[model samples]
Target: MERTTDPVDETPLTAEEYEAVHAAVAAAAGSRSRSLNSLFADWKDVVEDVEEGYSLCAPEFDDDLACRDALGRAWPLLPPRVRAIRRPELDELDGRFRAATVPWPGRPEEPHQWWRYRIPLVVEAEAGLPRPGGWPLGWEVLPFPKPAGVRVVEWGRP
Candidate 1:
């Protein structure tokens, strides 16, 4: 189904405007060898709006709703003919977003142990992600043990 937003200022977007945003987003994702997933799927369209000098957003039904909410605020200032693409129905956007942001590493069948340095050198390098401090960067060289979960861990000299 084609979902559209309320008309702004009695003017609708032109085809060229839509195409421009679409192309910009495609270029961004394509350069990274990634396709636009749910959370950022509408990026192409949004980029077009940005190029036209405005912000636009399309709503979603899942976790992407949070991302959309954060990004939507700027829509009103977006350029002419910029329309937002609504979220997809599959709801897999959340998973895709998670995977994209936080990548899983190492073989599941192998023993996993990741230290802060090791994580940044191994998984982060392979994934082309940045080196994050303060934790092991959520890396696991071995399979996560059964009944294992994350909780607050404090560190300081008493």
Candidate 2:
């Protein structure tokens, strides 16, 4: 399900590396009572949204709601390392994004709407992280474990 404008720059991971990453990510997910498979699965559609340049998700329910809900629900469950890496930048960008967005600018009065643009990499990607490795050049090696050689990165990317 992963798609990128360019191929990964580094040498590809071997099967052992792949298992290690999966185990690490799974461990991290288990620590937080989440499922490794489920979180990335949620991201599947969110990534589609980024690729399609469609970010005007409604607060109400729809076909998109499942992925949206999953992402939101999975936020706290994400590894602390992952959140720490993405949060600060996403917070700042979200502020600017909420202000500059066209009609989709969410209402500040409604607290829930205020957070509509807080999606981490997706916001930055739409804001033009360039199109190459910008997805990760946003330096986003998501849902990964420690910054070891093994990272539960975009396994879906081929």
Flag clash pairs in model 1. Answer: 13-81, 21-48, 54-78, 54-79, 55-75, 55-78, 111-142, 112-141, 112-142
Report the number of the highest-TM-score candidate: 2
The alpha-carbon lDDT assigned to residue 36 of candidate 2 equals: 43
For residues 1-158, write the lDDT of model 1, one tens digit per residue. Answer: 23345444245447775555445444433432332243254633332332332211112112223334333433333333343343332224333433222222442322221111011111111223332332222322224421122221222325
TM-score of each: 0.25, 0.28
lDDT of 2 by residue, 83-152 (tens): 4443554465345534433222232344444434333323322332343322334334322222332122
- Model 1 segments more than 4 A misplaced: 1-5, 9-12, 31-138, 141-158
Q: State which candidate has the highest lDDT.
A: 2
Considering only N, C-alpha and C atoms within 3 Å, which residue pairs clash in candidate 2?
136-139
Global fold similarity of model 1 (TM-score):
0.25
Per-model clash counts, in order, read: 9, 1
| C-alpha positional error of residue 144 in candidate 2 after TM-score superposition, expressed in Å | 41
